[model samples]
Target chain A: MRVHELETPAVLIDLDVMERNLARMAEYCRRHGLALRPHTKTHKIPELAHRQMASGASGITVAKLGEAEVMIQAGLTDVLIAYPIVGREKAARLAALAERASLTVALDSEEAVRDISRSAQERGVRLGLLVELDIGFRRCGVQRPDEAVALARLIHDLPNVDFRGVMFYPGHFMAPEPERRQLLEDANTRLRRFYDAFERAGLSIGVVSGGSTPTAFISHEFLGVTEIRPGMYIFNDRTMVGLGVARPEDCALSILVTVVSTSVSGRAIVDGGSKTFSTDRYRAGDGRGFGLVCEDPEAEVEALSEEHGHLDISRSSRRYRVGERLRIIPNHVCTVMNLHDEVYGIRGDQVEAVWRVAARGRVR
Target chain B: MRVHELETPAVLIDLDVMERNLARMAEYCRRHGLALRPHTKTHKIPELAHRQMASGASGITVAKLGEAEVMIQAGLTDVLIAYPIVGREKAARLAALAERASLTVALDSEEAVRDISRSAQERGVRLGLLVELDIGFRRCGVQRPDEAVALARLIHDLPNVDFRGVMFYPGHFMAPEPERRQLLEDANTRLRRFYDAFERAGLSIGVVSGGSTPTAFISHEFLGVTEIRPGMYIFNDRTMVGLGVARPEDCALSILVTVVSTSVSGRAIVDGGSKTFSTDRYRAGDGRGFGLVCEDPEAEVEALSEEHGHLDISRSSRRYRVGERLRIIPNHVCTVMNLHDEVYGIRGDQVEAVWRVAARGRVR
Candidate 1:
């Protein structure tokens, strides 16, 4: 069925466009001699993971175990879990995952290495681990080279865990006119220093990984980085747009919403709301709630009830009446895609196929 | 199985307590002489809806057409959609739903009345409509009594649409206690006046519905209201707690999460993140995020990533450590329950059943 006939608030992804988008990134990675490991957390579709593998990606990176499991089951063998598996439950799960494929998990602590090793040895599987050194985005990962060396040493000494490489994400460095050279040099120094420390301690550093979508453009100049994991580049978003990584049309996914009401002369309401766009409002210089345009630049999703999207439309946008549709490129595409069960592959106006969001509600 | 044996970041409901909660609400409505029309949007489980009906509820209220369809398929004969459905796609679905069961829809405009009438005319059954009046939420519904009268007139004049009654929400009025009486009075008076206008215009004003867990406490005082549509009273949350509506123990739903990590002697991380507690972080007063401490009242869910819940514990909660299980009462139970596909029913510490959240993603 066509997208319009399907329903409002449904996720539409043009398969032909998505493939081109996927192929475009794949081509870029190949041209740059970079091993492409697209993050599966962006789409969470096992089919997309398989497609990415077929398009010549060296491996795939998943944010959560639930995503890793889905991709592994779909026959995309090489998987990198780019998050710390800290708890006993997850450690045990990661051990099982390691047995299924060439699994590499990121760790930022000696305790994590010990806990993961306990599970890995029990399962008779060796887990390849990366020391996540922080370049920016101070969420997870070891901050200092000394901490990285200690964690790497611990992983290297573990019974069933191997220290593959050191990873760092210069997420905050993804500037539009990226301070490309300085950021790359900084990342190289941090990673190489950490990697060298492990080597000095009589350890082999095999993999060096980092960089997200915004910083992906300068992947060739990555210092001491053997590989990069750039996920959002597959389906660019307003976040990418704001970072000047990709243009609006480059985004493969969009929420196709129909005008649900137009009773008020100049005010029209769409069928999508917080349940669709979510509460991730990106002001990106001057955009309103999420990616929606409003009269005032500082437009918050000003007000969102459960089912209604209260957009304070600009005067020109208000002129657009009921029954029309608008394509909303979300600030964070991953979160928006996670909210739906399926996304349509749209070729122009034709809905080529509906792909099941196989990993939906896989929040573990 | 024990609750701890289950995966981290899972939805949990105390079945015994939920049954008790249902009976309590049903009993209160009965004693107060009001027809209980529980909004199924909170739970969206047919089993719960059936239990609600069995416990003396007159009917179920759904927020979307997909929800109504699911309820009808589950043998719920009478359902009221508390959302304004306006498009051809949804209108057609609503008409088809009317053919399956006794359906009532909320409408706030003459255009919506025309659309519903058109859809109803296509089907053999007449559409039951409730004129929604604005009671200060200022989100949807007609502003004044006369505007509601105009819509009522439109519905009454239509051949296939029946003007059922007046429906409005005093959701904003549900502010603990001091302002609730005044808000309730003001909203009910406006609604009753519209009901009178409908009556004077010879239109049937069968149901006068209003809602909220906070205001539902004083529902007995709302004599003109025909039915009450309180949703979250079953799974009382932080919002209810903040409004002084219900105490902590009264909450039936909670997220069962495992502590995944601990940062030295400082912060502890859980598997429950935005995906589990959901990204619905509306701080009531000064609370940082969307959940309350299940064990310690002073602690609140401070931050959440897509897959990590960063709970900021007070200095008193220092005893909480890694590998321990904690129950979290979400800030908004309706949104949290909607985020998951299933919820485990627990009795004491044993997981008795795993109920699929069948109508979980019917946000359309």
Candidate 2:
């Protein structure tokens, strides 16, 4: 099928651009002597994960065990769940996956560690553990260095769990250009304190994993970081462009939508809305609307309802008639991918392949 | 399975509360002498739609053709797609659905009518058309009464399409108490002008359909309205409560999540985030947090990442530890339902049944 022949509000991925993005990230990691562990939460497609591994990614990172299970079932042997897993059900599932794969998980609480340890022991499998450090994003991770060391010690003392290393995320460092460089430096300075604390306690931190798309290129500035796990690098979005991480043309993913309604004076409605493009705003507050209109740059997506994307075309030089097709580079590609069932891999005007978003809605 | 035994970040619907909500709306429509066409976009479950139809609903309304197809496949013979659908793919699909079901579509453009007319002619099926009027939503629909009459005439002259009536959505009338009443009155006054124009043009408006959850009860005050299409009445949310339409206790849908991390100082993280509960905020901007914490009302969900819901527990008397379960009444239940795959129907503490969100991710 051709790109224009697909139905409206369909997710389209430029295969050439996506391959270039994968190769660029892999080459960057090789040059920096770092292991690339691309996060699978971005696309949630096992085919994409296999492509990443073929392009030289050491392993893959997942946000949940549900996503990890999908990747593992697709024969991706090395997996890292970068979130805290609690409760008996999740712990048992994680331990079961470890029996046939190199499974590792991150945690910050002793209760979670104990549950995982028991599950691993019952399954007679060894599991790797990484103590999560709160580098700046206050959403998760242990705040104090002492607390992280305590959790590391607890993991070492467990029956089947080993203290692998530590992990941190600098989600607040998404700034433009030189300013972002300074923010990454500041975040790295704070991360070094925890690294030193763990070293002073005679703990061997073999794997110091941390990296987001915003700081993917400059990750080497963070001392003691051995690996990078950037998800959105595969399909950069408007947020990434606004943060100076990627150029507008480098954005590989876009929603192919049509102008469904143009009766309103200044606004036109597209078929894609919050359900397809999502309501996740840009972090920099760039005020670049919901996304960038590839066909008409001046047209802005002012707001979105459940199934309607309101495009403000008052400033555009060209007028869009009803039924005309347009492509939109969403503000955040990860959430947009999660909302769709299948995505078309396109090269130029033709669709190369169709891949199911196998792990979509796997939020468990 | 018991409620406690279910997985975290799960959507749970209280059967008793849901039944009560359905009964109240059905009785209201009966007393007002209006047909109730409940919108299935709220729950997107066939079982729930069957319950509504059994409770005296005339039919069901959907936002997309994909949803209409799902309902038709489940044996629903009557469905109205309340959106402007363009493109050849959608027109063909809509015509095909019209063959098996009493399908009606709302549109405001001549091009759309011609496309649907051609598809209906190709399939040898008659489609019911509604001239969509912009009742101040500014999202879609014709702007003026003359424009609506022109489209109605076009529909009347089409090959296999019949001009059924007019449709309007008072989306901008969401407010609290006396203010909401006044807004609804102001909107109705505008709607009366359009109805008068259509009547003067010798067009028989068989079905004047309009209603939103915020103004569902007061829809009878609008003189020309013959039917009400309320979607959120099935599963009310914080937005409905803020609009003074439904009380907090009236919300039937709630997300059951477990506290995954409490190591952070004044906050704790839950297993659900934008992926589970969605990024839709409260419309009133009442600073009510993402959703109301049912167990600890004082606990505010200050921030949300992709996989973590950060709860501010400074004002709460209760201290939430890791693995502690809590229920959250989402700000918008419709979008929340679209995010999950399955919802549990619960009676008290026991799970009565588990129903798949049959029409979820149907954003074509």
Candidate 3:
């Protein structure tokens, strides 16, 4: 089927561009001697994860246990839960997953370590553990190098847990080249402190995993990092374009919407809104609109209600009519992917495949 | 099962509070001599819509045609899709739905009217139509009162279409009482223009629909409104609390999440983030946090990544540990509901039932 024949508010993936993205990332990692473990949190599709593995990914990384379960059900053997596993229920789920796959988890707290260790011990499974460090992005992870070493030593000594290495998210350095390079260097210096402390403590930290979509290309500059987990590189977004990491054409995903109302003088309303594109601000850009209108550079999704994408067409010379279809590039693709159940993979105007976002809303 | 036993990042709806909310709105609309058509876009659950209907709602309102389909399949006979139906595909879908249900749609443009009319005629179904007016919320609708009258006359003259009336959304008047009253009166005066124009045009204008959660109680002040559509009243959110329309105790919906990391001195990370709670800003409140932590008044979800909710516990005297569960009242309940598959309806600590968010991602 043709793309234009599909329903409005449908998410479309340019298969050619996506394949290019997959090959480019794989080639980059291969040349750099870095293991690529693409995070499935962005796409949340088992088919895409399988394709990533086929394209040279060592394993898959997921944010939640439910997502890991979905991927494992699709026959993925090597998996990593990159987020901390807390509580007995989640620990038990993680341990059950470990029974089927070569499982690894990253955590920063001793409490998380105890929870997962107890479940792993009960299930007779050895789980690979990575200590998470808050190099600069202070959302999660241990704040100090001493804290990382303490967690590493504790994980190494724990039964049924193998001390894998360390993981950190450099999500804050999405600025231009010079500034981003400086921030990565600063973070790399701080990351070396944890590695140096582990060496002094006579520990072998085998896997140093750290990378984000913006910093994936500069992984070689990340000091002793052995692997990278970049999720959004598969189908880049407006944020990636704003960060200068990807071009507008590199964004493989776009939300197709039909203009529903054009009665308001300067504004046109589309069928998709915050529920379709989400209210994620374009903080990486000028922080003005919700998404970029692919049809017109001057037009932007100025605002959104639950089901209305308010397009500000005041600056655009072209007038929008009701029933006119337009494609929008959302500011954040991950959240948009989670909002939908399926996405269409297209080559030109032809629909090549329809992939279910199988793990969508698997927030547990 | 108990609420605490449920997995982390689960959406919870307090049945007791929700029932009370239903009763209160029913009573208020009864006393005001107005029909209450609660918008189902907030919960997106068929059971909740049934409960609202049982509580004296005239019908259920939805934001999209797909949502209308979900409600119709659940045996709902009356539905008003309070969104424009553009394109032949959506018009055809709406026409098919009208065959089974008493369907009404709101539109503001001639193109929309033509599209829906063509499909309704083809399907041999009479679809009710309402001319949407822009009553200060510059989202969707005709900007002028004359435009509304013109659309109403056009609909009245069209075949296979019944001109219901006019629908306006006063969504921007969510301030404190005095300020909100003033704004409502201002909108009322503006709304009078459309009714007077209709009267001059010899239009009956039977069903005048208008209202939002923040302006539902004061909907009587909307000069000629006969029915009100309030979506978020049943599951009041932090935004309603910030607007002073609903108290914190009145909020029926919340997200249950576990503290996954507290290694940082003043920040604690929870399992739910933008994917769980959404990136909707608390625009009605101080706009400082993503959501309000119900345990401590001072603590707030300061930020969010894709899978991590960063809690700012710096102002509070509470010490958070890993595996600790926290309930968060999201800033906007509608978007949060769209993020989950099922919500646990609870009575105190006990989980009463689980309802699928039937129209969760029906953004089309």
Candidate 4:
């Protein structure tokens, strides 16, 4: 079947573009002597993670135990749960997963470490632990270098736990050109401080995982970083485009939507909305609209209800009639992918595959 | 199983609270002599929709044909797809669905009307259509009253199409009391003009559907509105609380999340984030956070990444530790419900049932 023949509000993945993106990222990481463990939170597909592994990814990184379970069940032997795992049930589940695969977890708090350690010891399984450092992204990880060393020391003492290394997410480094470069420099300085602290503590940091799509290509600049866990690089989005990291042509995924209503003047409504494309705005740009209209670049999706994409066609010279199909590259691809149950993989106009987003909505 | 024993980042629906919400709305519509066609987009479960039907609902309202199909398959005889049905394939699907159930589609454009009319005629199915009017919310409706009459006339002329009066979404009338009163007055004036235009056109307007959660109770204030379609009243969120339409105690759905990280000084991280709770801010409030922390009402979900809910617990006098469970009422319940696959129906602390969000992600 053709891509256009598919249902409206369908997610389409350009196979050629996606393959190129994966190959490019894999090659970049290989050249930099960095292990590529592309985050599976973006696509949430086990097959795509397998493809990433086939493209020379060392392992796969996931944000939740549910996602890791999906990947492990799909024959993946090595996996990393990048988020902190707390609670007795989750820790027990993590230990159970560790029994099946070579599992690693990155966490900040000593409480989480102890929780997981107790579960792993009870299950008689060894799990790799990466002390998460709060280099800049203030969401997770420890603040000071001493805190990181303390966590590492605690992990080293914990039974059934291996102190692998440190991991930090430079999410704040997604600024544009010159500003991004400066942010990278500051991030590297912070990395050096953590490395110096680790060395002074007589700790051998085996793996230093840190990278986002904005800083993926410059992973070498981090000096001591060993692995890159960029998720969005596999399927580029408008945020990556706005950050000058990926071109519009590099965006592999697009929502095929049909114009449902053009009754309101200067605005047309599409079948896709927040429930389809999500409410994630283009933060890397002017922070205005929800997506980039591929049909008419000037047409802006100004607002969205649950199932109505309010397209501002005032700027576009082209006229949109109801039932007309249009493709939109959403601002954030990760959230958009998570919203759907399945996605179509297309080669040009032909639908080659329909892959169920097996790991989507696995927030547990 | 207990609700607490369930996994973190799980969607929990207080069944008692939901039943009370359903009963209240039913009684309100019964007293007001309005047809209560509650929108099922909030819960998206076939059973919940059936429960709404059991609660004296005239019919059920859905935003997409996929949702209509789900409801119809679940033995609903009357379902109103309160959204535009565009494209040949979708129209064919709509026609096919009409063969099994009484389906009414609401659209603003003549192109959509003609498109669906062609399919319905070919399939020997007479489909009902409501000419959507822009009462105040400028999303997907005709601006002028004359345009609505014109669309009605066109629908009347079209083969296999029944003109079922008019419909409008009063989404803009969700302000606080004083401002909301003014907006409602403006909306009523606009609705009156549409009614006058329909009367002058010699149109027997059978149905006048209008209402959102905010404007649902005041639906009788609109002179010609005969049906109310409020979705969020089933699972009230922080938005409804902020709008003073529903209190925090009235919210039926709350996400069960685990506090994962507390390393950051005034902030804590929960397992639920934009992918779980969504990026929709609390528009009815000060619009600072993504959700209301039910544990400490003063604590706010300041920001969200894909898998991390950043909680600002500075104002709360409580200190959060790792493994602590928190329940969050999201800003928008509809979008939050769309992100999850299933919801646990609980009675107090006991899990009574597990419901699959059957109609979720059916944007087509």
Candidate 5:
């Protein structure tokens, strides 16, 4: 099937562009002697994960155990769950999954470590544990280097878990070009202190995994980091473009939508809305609207309801009529991919393959 | 199964609360002598639609044709798609759905009318058409009454399409109590003019359908409105409470999430994030965080990542520990329902039933 032949509100991935993104990131990692473990939370497809692995990814990183289970089922044995796992039910599930695949989990609290230790002991499997240090993103992770060493020491003494190094997400430092480079350098300086604290505590750090799409290319500045995990680099998004990590042309995924209504002047409604493109905003405070229209660069998606994307076409000279199809580059491709069940991989106009979003809705 | 037995990050519908909400709305419509056509976009479950139909709904309203198809498969014969659908693929699918159900579509343009007419003609079925008028909400509707009449006339003269009355969504008039009454009255005055103009054109208005959740109870204030279609009344959210349409106790749906991390001093992280609760902000601008934490009202969900909801518990007296479960009332229940695949209907602490979100991801 061709791109024009498909239905509206469908997710389209330019395979050529995606392959180029994959190769570029892989080569950059190889040049820096950094192990690449691309996060699968962006595409959530087994085919894409396999491609990343074939291109030179040592392992795949998932946000939850549900996503890791899906990847394990697809024969991707090495997996790293980058979120803190709590609750007895989830720990048990993770321990069971670890028996089948080489599993690693990030932890910040001792309670979570004890819970996972018990689950792994019951399942008779050893799980790799990474102490999550707060490099700046205050969402999760240990706040201080002392806390990181404490957690690492606790994990090392645990019966069924191995203390692997530390991991941090510098998501708070998303800026464009030179500013981003400086932000990364500052974050790396703090992270190196945390790594040295672990060494001073007589702990040998094996994997210092830390890197987001905004700072993926400049990850080498973080001297002690051994691996980098960048999720959105596979698809990219308006956020990456705003942060100067990627150009608009480097975005591989887009939503193919049709102009459904054009009754109101200066505005046109597209078939794709919050349910299709998602409500992810550019975190860099760029205020570039919800998504960008690829055909008319001037057209801005001012607002989005559940099923109607309100497009502001006042600045554009071209008039859009009903039934006209438009491709939109979403603000964040990760959330958009999670919203759809399947995505079409297109080469030029022809759809090369249809891949199911394998781990979509795997929030657990 | 019991509520406690269910995993974390689950969508739970309080069956007793849901039944009371359904009854209250049905009784409101009954007292007003208006036909009840409850929009099914809130729950998107076949069982819930059946319950609404049993409560005295004349029909069900869906946002997309894919939803109508799901309703039709569940033996629902009456459905109105309350959006302007374009493209040949959708029109053909809509026509096929019309053959199985009493299908009606909302249209603001002549091109959509012609497209549906051709599809209905090809399928040898007559589809009902409603001219959507922009009374106040300037979304997907004709701005002027003459444009509505023109579209209605076109539908009236079409090959296999019948011109129904008209439909309008007063979404912008969402306010609380006495102020909301004034807003509805003002919107009704403008809508009355459009209805009168359609009558002046010799078009007999059979079904003047309009009413959102915020203005559902006082729908009779709009003199000529014969029916009301409100989706969110079934599962009221923080937005509805801020608009004074429903109180917090009246909300039926709440996400059951477990606290995964509490390393931060004033903050705790839940298992549900944007992927589970969605990124819909409070529409009434109440400044309340993403969703209200039910157990501790003072605790606010300050921010959300893809799989983690950060909660600020400094103001709350209750202390949350890891693995502790909390119920959250989302800002918008419609979008949250779309995010999950299934919802558990519970009575008190017991799970009554598990209903699949039948029309989930039906963006087409």
Candidate 6:
């Protein structure tokens, strides 16, 4: 649908720009000699995964087994689940998925390793599992080097299981820090220590994966990493701009919304609300609220209701009268795209294609 | 699925409890001699709408044309779209829905009225339009009674359109307060003035509708209003408990979540993240966070990541271990249910039935 003629609060993806972004990231990985596994959790659409593969991605990375299942059904064979799997039902699901495709799972704890091993033995399938190590963020993963070594030893000793390499997420390194030599050297030291422990355990690790979007930009010298998974590079959002990674023109996906009314301090209320933008709050240091106004970069959407997005478009000299359509670049692209069923892929204001978010509600 | 066997972070709706809640609202409306037009936007499944009709609801209300289309396709005959129709696509869609169903639409401006009137006239159907007056919340609707009258006059002057009545929403009054009487009275004053203006404009106003969950629990006497549309009472949430409108036990919908990890203090990470419990946040003076910690009313969920829900889960001497499940009353019940493609309706721990959120992704 045309932007001016269609309804407000619809998700829009620029197809030409997105193809360029996919190619740029793929070429970056090729030039740096890093295996590219774009996270399907970001776009969660099979077509986008196919596009990433066509652009030279080695495989797909997912956050959940259900997401991996969708990719497998869509002909994406090599898949990596970046989440630790526990529970009898979940392990069975993982084992079943491993039977169809090359599945590698993450294990962060002793309990997880034992559980996964037991499930793999019961299913009579050799499960490929990675021991997760936390470099920072303090969310998941083993912090101690000895613990990582022990996890790898346990998984290797168990029946019907193969111990893959370690996985560490250095999310804290993505803050656009002033690249001190100490920070770089310290990250290398930790990685070296972990790999040394794995070597001492007499285990041959298959893949040593680490780095996110912001971290992968400087990952060429991260020393001991084999693969990099950067999902949001294909659809840079306001958060990327806030973190100083990408520019506004680099944002590939934007919400096509209309100005429903202009009232209350010239505030134009759009039809998008928390349901569309999500309730994610980001501290960009400037204290701008909700999401970044895309059509007008300086404009701010200070508040959101369930069905109403409020924007402070009062000060712009541009005339945005009622029924005017505007595009919004959300702060967090992954979460916002996850909230929609399908997004229109526009090529210079023409609706070229519609991509169904294949794994939109695969939260299991 | 059985409550104990089903995966954590899944939504569970007890059919028996939901029926009781639905009966309670219907009985209250019957006693008050008021028409109950339950808004189906809460649970977009048409089966629930059919059950509501079987229990004596005058009609069901929808938030968007996409949702209305889904319900109508499921054989629902009458629907009231409680939001304005502003675009060509939406107006045309609304007119198409009018052919087979008795549709009542809310309009607060002449532009929307003329848009709907033009489409409905072309389709040879008279569209029923309600003049939405602002009572509070400052979102949509005409600001004053005279503006509502002017809008009604314009709607009546247009061909193939009927002025249904004045619709005013007191959403800000949904917060619990001792001054609830003043809030309701203030809302009534504006609505009564609008009703008089409609009469002075020689309009045949049919339905005066207004009510949210908080206002539904109290006296819903809006001067000359004939109907009240409250959707969340069927599945109460923590927002209801926080507002002192409903007790925790009344929350029939909950996210059955498993404690995935334990780090320090009484903190535990649940499998439910913003994807499941949603990211809606509202606090009372006591400073309640995302949700009220079940079994420990004093505790709250302090933080949330993409796939992790952080909870300060204990206020007593009992320690919370990993693998334990906690039932989470979400901040907003409506949005939480919408996130899921389907919900399990159970009784105690037994699996009874599954309901498809037929219009979950119908956010046009």
lDDT of 6 by residue, A77-102 (tens): 99988877767788888888878888
Local accuracy of candidate 2 as per-residue lDDT tens digits, A187-248: 77778889888989989898989998988998888888999999999999999998878999
Model 6 docking grade: acceptable
- Go through the candidates in order and give each one's C-alpha lDDT: 0.76, 0.90, 0.89, 0.90, 0.89, 0.79
Each candidate: RMSD = 3.3, 1.3, 1.3, 1.5, 1.5, 2.6
Query: What tens digits encode model 2's per-residue C-alpha lDDT throughout B1-364?
Result: 9999998889999999999999999999999999999999999999899999999999999999999989989988899999987877799999999989999999989989999999999999999999898877788889888888899999988799999998988887766677776776777787888888888999889998999898899889887889989999998998888777889889999999999999878899999998988888788757457888999888998777889998999888897899989999988899899988899999999999999998999998
User: Which portions of model 5 miss their true places by more than 4 Å?
Assistant: A176-182, B176-182
Residues A1-364, model 3: lDDT tens digits:
9999999889999999999999999999999999999999899999999999999999999988999999999999999889999999989999999999999999999999988999999999999999988888888889887788888888877899999888888877867778887797789789778778889988888998988899999899898989999999999999889888999989999999998888777898888888888888786757788888888999978888878889889989988888889999999889999999999999999999999999999988
Cα deviation in Å at residue B332, candidate 2? 0.9
Candidate 5 falls in which docking quality class? high
Model 2 is docked with a DockQ of 0.85
**Clash number for every model?**
2, 0, 0, 0, 0, 0
Docking class of 2: high
* Model 1 regions more than 4 Å off: A15-20, A86-92, A109-111, A169-193, A218-223, A263-267, A286-288, A293-301, A314-317, A320-322, B174-182, B185-189, B220-223, B263-265, B295-300, B313-321
lDDT of 3 at A159: 90
True contacts kept of each: 0.31, 0.85, 0.99, 0.99, 0.79, 0.25
Q: Model 1 chain A: which ten-residue window has the lowest total lDDT? A: A292-301
Candidate 3 lands at a TM-score of 0.98
Query: Evaluated against the true chain A, what TM-score does chain A of model 5 have?
Result: 0.97
TM-score of each: 0.91, 0.98, 0.98, 0.98, 0.98, 0.94
Q: Candidate 6, residue A116: CA error in Å?
A: 2.4
In candidate 2, what fraction of native interface contacts survive? 0.85
Candidate number that wins on TM-score, 3 or 5: 3
